[model samples]
Target: MLLHILARGRIARSPEGELLDRYLKRVTWAVKHTELPDRGGNIPPLPAQARTVLLDERGKQFSSEEFAAMLGRWRDDGVREARFVIGAADGHGDVARGEADVLIAFGAMTWPHLMARAMLAEQLWRATAILSGHPYHRAG
Candidate 1:
């Protein structure tokens, strides 16, 4: 399955962007990264057989193993793409949240959008690695 990240705002040449790139590079699965303007911008239409995951403060927090399991299930079920949406500074609205297949949160604490993108990238790598029985993720 394709792992796509659709995040608001340009990461530019910041350290966060480098970090995000580093982790994404380690992912064996197909990956895509798209950036939208912080404000108004067109969001690409979702492809058929794709699942949308919205990163929101009120979303559920999953363990690394659980997340890997979910992704494996989706891949096994023939999901073509798993798109993860990260909203702007204010986050996503109710309508978008309602349309999402899943809502996930890093934690209750707020994180900068750039950092969130980097964090998400790392998690994606970790999840994929876990799924492949890689030793990178050490779970108790």
Candidate 2:
């Protein structure tokens, strides 16, 4: 399945962007990153058979293993694309949240949007690694 990250705001050239890129590079699965303006901008059309995941403060927090299992199931079920969306500072609207297949959170604490992007990248890498039985993720 394709892992697509649709995040708001320009990441630009920064340490966070570099970190995000580094993790994404390690992911064996297909990956795509799209950036939207902090305010208004056109979001790319969702591909057919795509599942949308919205990152929200009130969302459920899943363990790395659980996340991997979910992704594996989606892939096995022939999901073409899994789009993870990171909204702007004000966060996502009710309509967007309602339309999402799932709403996930890093934790209760608030994270900077850039750092969240990097963290999400790392988690994606970790999830794929865990699914592939990679030694990179050692769970107790």
Candidate 3:
């Protein structure tokens, strides 16, 4: 399945952007990244067989193995695209959260949008690697 990140705000050329780029390069799966303005922007149409995952503070936290398994299950079930949405600075509204197929959290601590994007990139890489039978030394 395709792994897509639909996040708010431009990462620009900052350190976080560089980190995100580094991890994204390591991911072997089909991947796409979309950046929108902090305020208003029209989201692209979802692909057929799409699953939307919202990154929110109140969401469930999953282990790396669990995340990999979830993606694997979706792929095995013929999901075409797994879109992960990262909200703006103030975070997502209730409507968005309610509409999501899944809600995930990085941790309890608050992180800057740019950093969160980078972290998400790394996690995606790790999850895909684990799913492909690669050894993850620090896996939880």
lDDT of 2 by residue, 1-140 (tens): 99999999999999999999999999999999999999999988898888999999989999999999999999999999999999999999999999999999999999999999999999999999999999999999
Candidate 1 structure, TM-score to reference? 0.98
* Residue ranges of candidate 1 with Cα displaced over 4 Å: none
lDDT tens readout by residue for model 1, 120-139: 99999999999998999999
Indicate the TM-score of model 3: 0.96
Tens digit of per-residue lDDT, candidate 3, span 1-140: 88999999999999999999999999999999999999999999998899999999999999988998999999999999999999998999999998999999988999998999999999999999888887753654
Error of 1 at 65 (Å): 0.6
What is the lDDT, from 0 to 100, of the residue 38 in candidate 3?
90
| Candidate 2 global CA lDDT score | 0.96
Provide the TM-score for each candidate, comma-separated: 0.98, 0.98, 0.96
Clashing residue pairs in candidate 3 are: none
- Listed per model in order, the count of residue pairs whose N, CA or C atoms clash below 3 Å is 0, 0, 0
